[model samples]
Target: MEYKWIALSNTTIGVLMAAINGTIIIISLPAIFRGIDINPLTSFQYLLWILMGYNIVTATLLVSFGRLSDIYGRVRLYNLGFLIFTIGSILLFLTPNTGDLGAIELISFRIVQGIGGAFLFANSAAIITDAFPAKERGKALGINQIAALAGSLIGLILGGILSVYYWRYVFLVSVPVGIFGTAWSYLKLKELGLRSKGEGIDWAGNTAFGLGLILLLIGVTYGLMPYGSSQTGWTDPYVMASMISGAALLVSFVFIERKVKYPMFRLELFKNRMFAAGNIASLLRSFAYGGLMIMIVIFLQGIWLPLHGYSYSETPFWAGVYTIPLMLGFVAMGPISGWLSDKYGSRFLATLGMVIVGIGFLLLTTLPYNFNYTEFALMLFFMGLGNGMFASPNTASIMNSVPAKYRGTASGMRSTLQNAGQTASIALFFTIVILSLESSLPTALATAVTNAGAPQLVPLVHNVPVTGALFAAFLGYDPVKALLANVPSNLIPATAIHIMEQRTWFPTAIAPAFMGALRNAFYIGGIMTFIAAIASALRGKRVIAEEKEEKEVIKNA
Candidate 1:
């Protein structure tokens, strides 16, 4: 194989592994929690930490790792990423403790995997750009992007299959693949990009940016927790303090970057319209894409699957199966769109892609809680198609617009924004769903319990944290079972218990409130994609002549 093909194959595997880890836990969380002997409802915080921790770490470290890769070597850091990720996988599989200790160990190990992921994500695009010519960059990146995106869907399937047998197998599945990729990368890949020589690392800038983003994301994470008598922790003093401090630090980081002789971030790269607009579009698109995926999963697993006769424990696997059309759409359009963008520029195709995504979101809002599987699948396919059309061309445009020496930093910045958007999307969309649930859930639960001849249990059921219920459903736990687990049978009739435990009972009861919030969330997602389309349109055409002129100016300056 040619060296470019070798680079592409190896980097694609790295990305696929990282992306698979990103969401494999989603479907497998039920089994994982069971393995650790943790109740999904009571230990909801651990669930959030495990789900969000990887993204948070990857988002925080991308730029730093990217800058380091430029100074040292992209291939070297990328190879190390594979090794470290594999190690994390081994640790996760070998978790010795049970209960909270095991959950903590898993979270900690996931962070290690996230650090490895940052290394892979930070350099993959830059590595590919270094190997492929500018004219062919879009197609190469398109193939790479397909693997990254498809890997998430694939993880859902693998998690469903593996977790059914053993939760440890979910993590263990990555080990052999990581080992092979790590060795292949070390043996076959070489550093071909321009390296920054003799420049000192910008410690102050790195600290400001890293700490600031960490604080802000932590604040967002905790902001979802309950505080005092409130349904959410947005009013907590510590949450307020963290957000304010984080905002101030990020501002300082910007100023520091402007003054640094060897800045970790390349602020000047944004001077090009293509770079700026492409990044903005990428962030917005990520926000919509990430949030949409979570909401759709909840819809499928929490409501539709059960309504369609699938048991609660079976929902996770089938939910993944149902969403396969979405992946198919991406596979169908990604490479073709990239090739076309190489000929016609990114503006038209990318913009059209976002517009289609917005339309898909709008269509999703019209879905009944018991939506037809065919209709739901079609909407998902359109969403994937639109995202596929945008991703590769937009990435190629951003990378091609930068000077060769700055590609590492540029790639890092792009990944940082994309990962950060995904992290924030969970916080943002979940908050929306939780808040919406809080308003109606208590009343809904009270009424349902009463109607089921369990009026004596209404008070206890009503006091359940809305987030606990959401997490229970998301993790494929029967909400009725978790809510009523501790309630004494003496207070409720056996018949009532039987009625409440019916497979469709909880889903049917929660469907109205969930559908209401889900539709509203879909509307918000639609608006985001619409704005992203505008950003894509504002990117204008990528003119090679103008790009050459800008490079010449930067070179002389």
Candidate 2:
């Protein structure tokens, strides 16, 4: 294969591996917690950490890593990323301890993997942009992006299948792929992108940005946990302090960057309308996309699958299977839209894609709790199609608009915003769902328990943390069974116990309330996507002449 093809294939593999690791843990979390002997209900903080830690790390480090790639070489850092990722995978698979220690080890190892992911995410687009001509950049990035997204969907399937046998296998699956990718990247990929030499590292800027983001994300993470009498820690002094301090640091970082001779991020790049608009749209789209997928999984596993006769144990796998059409839609449209973008420019296609995605979200809000599979699948496919249409062209516009030397930093900044959006989306969406559930779930649970002839258990069920219930359903466990596990069997009649444990019963009871909260989330997501579409529409046509002019200015300077 030619060098460009080599670069594309290797980076695609790297991104796929990283992306797969990202979501594979979601479906496998139940098995992982079980294997580690951690109760999902009581150890919700650990669950939250496991879910959000990798994203937080990647989001905070992308810009710094991207700038480093510019100073060193994209290929060099990318190769190192593959190696580090492989090592992290091996460590995760070889976890020896059980319980709290094991969970901590896993989370820590995943952070290592995230560091590797940051390197790959920061550099992959820059490498591809360097290899492909401007006209063909969209198509190449489309294929790479498709791999990344398809990997996420594929992870759900793989996690379902692998975790059925052994949770270790979920981490194990990545080992061989990572090894191959690392070696291939080292041997086949070359530094085709321009590198900046003699530019000093902006330690002050990097410190401020990284610390600020870290504090902010940490606050968001803790905000989901209960604090004292409150259902959430948003009012906790530590959380409030973290958010306030983090915001202050970020503001200071921006000022510091403006004054520094060598800044970690090139703030000037946002001056270009295409770059700014593309990044803004990318951020909003990611926020919507990330939260949407989580809600869809909860919808399927918590309500739809059980109503359709699938057991809780089987829901995770079947949910993955049912979602395949969505991935297929993305695969089908991604390359074609990318090629078209090369001809017509990204503004229209990307904006249209966002609009289509908004429509899909709106359609989801109209779904009844027991939605038809065909209709649900169609809506998912449309959303996927829209995302497919938007991702590549927007990425191309961002990369193509920047000068070659700054591509690494630009790519980093883009990934940082996108990843930050995704990380924040989880917290934002979960908080919304949990808050909604808090207001209504207690009354709903009490009514259901009383109706089921288990009125004695109403108080217990009413006090269940909304987050715990959501997590139980998300992990494909029967919430009723979990709640009833502590109740004395003698107090409830046999028939009542049976009814409470029935696959359909709990889902039916919780459906109305869950759907209400979920619909609210969908509406929020839809509104965000609509806003993103507007941003996308506002981006001007790509100007090749402007890029040439900027390149000349850089060379002269």
Candidate 2 lDDT over residue span 1-557, tens digit each: 77889999999999999999999999999999999998877888789889999999999999999999999999899899999989999999999999889989999999999999999999999999999988988999999999998999999999999999999999999999999999888888999878999999999999999999999999999999988867788999999999999999999999999999999989998898999999999999988878777878888899899998998989888888899888988998899989999888999999999999999989999999998888988988998899999999999989988888898999999999999999899888989899999989989889998998889987897778888888888998888778878877999999888888888898898999999999899899999999999999999978553468768899999
Every candidate's lDDT: 0.89, 0.91
Per-residue error (Å), model 1, residue 112: 0.9
Candidate 1 ranges beyond 4 A from true positions: 543-557
Which candidate leads in lDDT?
2
List clashing residue pairs in candidate 2: none
- Tell me how far the alpha carbon of residue 243 in candidate 1 is from the true structure, in angstroms, after superposition: 1.6
Per-prediction TM-score = 0.97, 0.98
Top TM-score hit = 2
* Tens-digit lDDT string for candidate 1 (1-557): 99999999999999999999998999999999999999867776798899899999999999999899889888889899999999999999999999889999999999999999999999999999999877888999999999998999999999999999999999999999999999999999999998998888999999999999999999998898888877789999999999999999999999999999999998888888999999999999888878777777888888889888898899898888899988988888899988988888889989999999999989988988887888888988998899899989999889888877788888999999999998888888888888888878888888888899999887897788887777777788788877877878788898999888888888888889988888788888889999999999998778443359678899999
